[model samples]
Target chain A: MSSEGTQPLGRARPQETPAVAAPLLRRGMGNLATVAAHLVLMTWTVFVAFPFLWMVVTSFKTDQEIFFSPWRLPSALRWENFARAWTDASIGRYFLNSLIVVTGAMVLTLLCASMTAYALARFDFPGNRILYYCFLAGLMFPVFLALVPLFFVVRDLHLVGTFQGLIIVYTAYSLPFSIFFLHGFFRSLPGEVAEAAIVDGASPYRVFFDVMLPMAQPGLVAVGIFNFLGQWNQFILPLILMPNPDRYVLSQGLAFLAIQRGYESDWSALFAGLTITMLPTLIVYVFFQRRVQQGLTVGALKG
Target chain B: MHHHKYRLIIPFVLPSALIYGVFVLWPYAQALYFSLTRWRGFSRNRPFVGLDNFERMLDDRLFWNALEHNALMLVVLPSATVALSLLFSALIAQGGRGLRGAEIYRIVSFFPQVMSAVVIGVLWSFVFHPNIGVLNGFLRVIGLGSLQRTWLGDPQWVLWAIALVAVWSSVGFFMILFIAGMQSIPTDLYDAATVDGASRWRAFFGITLPLLRDHLQVAFVFMGLSALDLFALVQVMAENGGPSRAADVIARYMYDLAFNKSQFGYATAIGVVLLILSLVLSVLVVQLTQRERIEF
Candidate 1:
């Protein structure tokens, strides 16, 4: 209850200190209230995780088992469902398409966004503020607004339904956020490092690539993951631009599978396809949960 | 040095600017032009029809319905998501007691944010699938069978059902944001409140809520923007707007107009309206949230 004790908690360990104070404040609420809080948290955790768990479990169940025992665990591991989804169902093709486009877009976005961010952060130039605002303005304008004209633009370039086209669109669409997020990181970097490198006769390009880009690795990773998740999961843009089924990305392919539910098909493969579509992002998220969370929240809160 | 700095800046900035221009800015400018012309997106020849597309949009009942659906989502999604997120964040932050295992719960709750909206939509559509859906099965098992309804199929329930999915998908994110926001609040305020015999609710309303205004504002605006952009979910889950176009949102309607019906000019008008709406909301959010930052 002392000011002396609580002031330190306020300045240090912003994410951790609140936990130390919360329970004491809520002590009068007693064990039952605490238990109720736990219960609510656990229930929502289950609610959020269950659909994903269901997708994975259902992928291994036969149609009859899925229909008859919707809640029950699958009786056997049906690995073939994934096989079917991969081979016959074309989820494999879609997965490969996604891998190509997501990687291409992520790399392109990182390179360009970092370059732009570095310029805006480090250099003094005309139109710098205008260019920065131009990118930032893209944050509010939904891609749907650009869908029509963007479609025609890509079509006119003869890149429609091509990986290169989707890559360009995704890269362009993602640049706003990537540049905005990276600009902050670049601005925060000690100017002395870049200045010393430049004085050592490192060209501006070399100072950027050799010195600054590596220094901005964390920023790059955050923006990279952000653009990766976004481009991988994009549906509407691909749906419009990539009309060929052969070029369908994972999201577009999954939607295609869902819409084709009325056709005669293996329900298990469909579920497996859904699982296949979700696994890469989920696995990446599990590994880099902190970075992914930071990426998403930063884009929303700060950028 | 100054001239060199300026020259170098162009190389660094040009790639991003060019790509962004060709793809984003140019398309948007074309959207303006196309909105004025009575042109099908595919073929070139078209007469100029100034304001006609916008006029048609004003008269279109379906556009209004779709906009209304988006407005509903804009209100419901952010409120429900932020509310539940605030509660969950508070619970998870109550770490001194039995709720010590906050990390797992936090991670698990955020599991949905990592997945594609298309995947979430497909997954939830199956979860809400009529006969074999897990929701209905669980309802039946709980003997609440009569309460179960065709969630996405019925017009009355479709929007709510989609909104619920959105809330589920979104809560973890906002929860994380609020948790971060709350952590930055000094523990002294809570201590003072405790000494004053202020109840937990009172401390929350007076101390926590006011301090967290900036975070809440950001969350609301971001979530609102998302609410407007529900193309993937609506397209995948509700089958491009459920029965009677009940769950149809502006983005999906624009897609249908551009792609399905080939009403390119009209669709561009819809897109312009969508742009205007988003810009308006964003400006409003900035204006609303621009209260003097509380330094504490």
Candidate 2:
């Protein structure tokens, strides 16, 4: 980079002397730049991954090792930490609960949001634009903003502690992004096939179910995985609504274990619980990394 | 055709509409109403008290303090995330031509984005644990033992500790966003800049930043909202606002008010304030960043 001004490339273009030298200088700087860039990137990668690594390693250590030999590698696998987390710590129950709610919420949110997205994208009905914007508006309504009234709404229906209530909340919360994302997909889809289906005297519902919905499968998968990760990781709603120990989701469960066990000698068990709670989403992310990343950008960019 | 429109629209839209309305819209409207009432969490015969809650919030020190923390977050979080993201994305994008491992680095950096905030909070708490923590241990390893402090326990360090986690978790997502933005910039412009003797830094400021206005706006809005909704971190890490309410933000405070103290009405007022604050910030961000797209 420092050698740019004196390089022969600068003498070639007198009109823009500095401009002519830049490419050559950049070429020379490339090697040094790559090393520097890698240094920064590697440092950040370590910064990002080290905690997770520490969490896993710490989970394998006994209480004494964690407290005393914090930096040392565990001598044994200590798989029983996981057992303690799953059974005595109750993360297993919470994991099961999370799976049920997230699955139900994913399916229901996809169903409702996609159907609405399809309508808004395909049909020119009265209030179509209005309805689309209304769903879009849901994006701004953070869960905390409606916590008090929503608690009352759920409690009034006598579903406060029920999975059904949480599922409903998750579905509603996930709808805005789902609809917005799928709306773009539904709109971009070729209208020719769906038009032909309509011309064949197929019912509107049948056309959607049989034809357009299938065509929107990619979008569905994108939104489905997005909703799944979101619902799986949800904390605030479950924390407020599911006070019952039996019904705690993974996030709430992990938090509970952290607080309850933080003061005890059960630190490794807490780490184990954190690891278990993080596993599903981590697997999903690792497997479907591209799709997950794209889904995140799709909502932000498209909206 | 007109009749068919309504037939298809109603069925397709009703399910989502009803759920969204009942869960989101109705509660929001009810929040607006509840903000004006003197109802406790369980009371049915709530009496109307117009603007009293808002008036109380005005005089509430804890509310103001929480708001101040949130305001600090709103300022610091997005700026840090955007700056770091831009730096990382630029390196990955330009990377001095053929920088190896950009793809791997990108993937690795995004690891935290996949985990839940609760997990991040728990893991960070362990990282900041005074005796057993990696951070303090590292400080001691490097002979900087005096610098090691209780990160989340000290009221002074707690908010910064939480903000660091926020930045850590979010930097990759925004980096991905900026990478997309940077990649879309026509390479010929950079080539031209190179040919014109512009330095990499000059090209970045002159060419890259101007084109990434839209992505920056998106980042600002998203990070701002995340800042305002920072409950999981503070809750799990600091054990609800940390020492002396040093790290308390609006969302956690509202949660405590409603759930802990049963001050449903007061909490609703806080929620309303948060809602309006978020809405205002969002609109302002959009308006502030609204500029004509420079077509390449």
Candidate 3:
């Protein structure tokens, strides 16, 4: 190949021109490879999508059809399964409980993590590095290590089985990662902006809330999404803390449905219940795919 | 002015510190104290037993077994995930026009990351059922019927099955990390490599891997820590880590000791051991991945 003709294929620059050489024979092979790539990707996508599709299909099937022929598509849609799951399984009460706990946790996590990150980013104080490392150490501590003792602490405080108590625990658990991510974003901001505000005689609090917080909206949204998804799907903590059936979150309630076994393997209702629990996360993920991906990338790579 | 600065910092910092201290740090200290005593989770008073819990843990074969499984997972899952992610990122990064479709694949792969481990466990359980399961059905249709096995039911395969799911769920997150690292590398480096007549593989080893060291280290540490926190999957998939604790990991074993057996002191001992192991592993990883900062 001539130097000019081969440059695009050989070079790794962003401005390289697209290669458009070769006769019909080479072009046919290229087309075939492209087709094969798409075929492979589509097959794997179906594999990933199957379980979710199965759950949705079975949720609409009759109880009789659930066991004998789980593979078959439902002949008639059964919408009442959702209603029965909501009432009989007490999912409505669980939904409300989850909402309260998640909302409270989200607010607490945002306030504490944001303020701590801002302070850490802007100020040069004694024990600053040590404090930051302490937070990082928290990230490495396994959640199960805290479980045995947290039970006692919560019980002693008489917060057990209370929404506010669970919210407290959730907030504490989420703080480390939230502060870590937000601290990175805060560090990336121009130092001159805060310096300028300081020179204007603006108090640190005003500079933080009035100026910096708005600039960190993307970080806030990212951390908020993480906290929401995490708190919503939290199972073990709520399972241990909230023993009262009336206060079950969606995950704990769905798990209870599976464990009862009295339903004689009523896979339809079980699938319906799981689908209800999973829908909100799946919807949020589909809508904010870019942000979620960006968040995960930033959180992992930057740290 | 300095005192005022201290005042500003303390007010903002104290609430979080106090809550975290009382809730997390204090309880951990309490766990250490309780491990030396035999408290049945509730009593008016309990007596100190002094090293009895640690001794019991040393002799407990199941504890050793669980630790072994956790070590295996820590080695297998993160390394495989990082390797696969690096490969995928390289391919996508090189295939400029094809990157759009690759983005969609990345999104689908990441769907599993947001899912609860319980849900993934349940879904995979059905797929791996001994009979009428999709996996076996597909195998039979493809004339690989002899290779099909009961994935979760068998003791030998259960840990592998669980580990496979963990690795699959994690690859997307790490893939995104590798992509980000790739994006940050200046395009000029690759051009210089091409000009030097370096093959793609050579260029990757020389240019991409060294520059991506920081990102790889971070991913490894995070994934390693995550593998140590393996509770929900074992709880849902194997329901007490299988028929005879064959799929047991440290976290699940700790849960069983604390909740099911109600051996509070023994469970606290196990928790202490887990904490130490995680700390040591994280420190070693950080040390091994440490490098003199590249000025570039």
Clashes of each: 0, 3, 0
Extract clashing residue pairs from model 2: A18-B197, A19-B196, A19-B197
lDDT of 1 by residue, B194-286 (tens): 879887788788888877776788888888898988888888878868999999998999899889988888898888898899889988876
User: Candidate 1's error at B281, in angstroms?
Assistant: 1.9
Query: What are the TM-scores, per candidate, against the unseen true structure?
Result: 0.93, 0.93, 0.86
Interface RMSD (Cα, Å) for model 2: 7.8
In terms of TM-score, the best-performing candidate is 1
Better of 1 and 2 by lDDT: 2
| Ranking of models by TM-score | 1, 2, 3
Q: How do the residues A1-303 of candidate 3 rate in per-residue lDDT, one tens digit apiece?
A: 122211222232211312211111122335554456556555555656777777778789887776456567888888888887777777777888998999999999999999888888778898998887777666766677778789889999999999989999898888888988888789988878877998999987888898999999988999998888788889889977998888888777766766663245666666677778788889989998767766655555444
Instruction: Calculate the i-RMS of every candidate, to one decimal place.
Output: 4.1, 7.8, 6.8
Reference-based lDDT, each prediction:
0.82, 0.84, 0.75
Ranking by DockQ: 1, 2, 3
Off by over 4 Å in 2: A1-27, A199-201, B1-7, B291-296
Q: Which residue pairs of candidate 3 clash?
A: none
Each candidate: RMSD to true structure? Answer: 3.7, 6.5, 5.9
Interface quality of candidate 3 as DockQ: 0.31
Instruction: Kindly list the per-residue Cα lDDT of model 3 for residues B1-296, writing each as its tens digit.
Output: 78767766887777777777777777777888877888675663658999988898878899899888888988898888888778766655544453347757667777888888877777677677676356776687779989899888889999998888888788777776666566556666766666677666686788778777777777888888878877888887787778678889888888888877777777887888888887887787777766433432
